[model samples]
Target: MAAIKPKHQRLVLALIALAAILAAGALATWALRNQASYFYVPSEIVANPPDLDRAVRLGGMVEMGSIEMEADGVTIRFVVGDGTARVPVRFKGLAPSLFVEGSGVVAEGKLAKDGTFIADNLLARHDENYVPRELQDMTEHQKDAVISETVGAK
Candidate 1:
């Protein structure tokens, strides 16, 4: 082999290492394909059966008048619907301030053998305006009181 200069040797070694790293990353990306969770609406879930015992995310509006408060205040149960179907869910924790009836929500959980989506986490989707749906129907006096109380804390 011809005598190689130190600088050229180092450059060639670095290039080889970089190429190896890139190939490793591409292989890893391909191997990890399908690791992402699939999200489905209530309608899609109801229409087809998914592989049992897999993680998924369901997003929709909490159905109106479907919230059922258990004997223990912490364990709240409710139903979420995406206009075509409904999914009942159970959550046991302090819900977000935005969690309310008839609001958009995304729940993360696994489907149980009985077909219910057992939520491990609950995230309420609130609009820029944080007013509760119930507050909109309240009289102006009630709305003003709520606003005052909300503002007083800040």
Candidate 2:
């Protein structure tokens, strides 16, 4: 039997390891492709929204005076505002207790064909003090008090 060189054996082993890693990465990516949910702002969705069937996240401030409660009380319609941009949202299920008009929120679900966001999940701060960007300029003491109050109330 011809003797194989040690360096060539090492090179072959390295190549095989690299190939295995690449294969695993590709498989993982393929598995997660359909599970990924993309996040979009109102402006982005207005210009180019993803497929209506695919799940996504829409984050913005709830437009004041645009929120309307249906007679059933379960079907709530409102508009999400990002300053210059806006997107209408319709939620059939119970919204988060913290959700309110003019509050910062993140809605996760799919968009309807008529430009309404059909949200299945909503995340929002119970009070304006809990919203970070709005609390950014507050003093450390003020921030601590807000945190304590929120935590204590909860």
Who wins the TM-score comparison?
1
Which regions of candidate 2 deviate over 4 angstroms? 1-37, 125-154
Q: Write the per-residue lDDT of candidate 2 for residues 36-120, one digit (tens) a residue.
A: 4376778778988889998899877787689898899789889986665789998888788768765667889998899899999
Q: Local error of candidate 1 at 104, Å?
A: 1.0
Best by lDDT: 2
Model 2 clash tally, residue pairs:
0
Taking the tens digit of each residue's C-alpha lDDT, what string does model 1 give over 53-91?
877777777877898889988788898776658888888
Q: Kindly give the number of clashing pairs for every candidate.
A: 0, 0
Scored by CA lDDT, what does every candidate get?
A: 0.73, 0.77
Between which residue pairs do clashes occur in model 1? none
Over 4 Å off in model 1, which ranges?
Answer: 1-37, 127-154
RMSD of each: 9.3, 9.1
**10 residues in a row with least lDDT, candidate 2:** 145-154
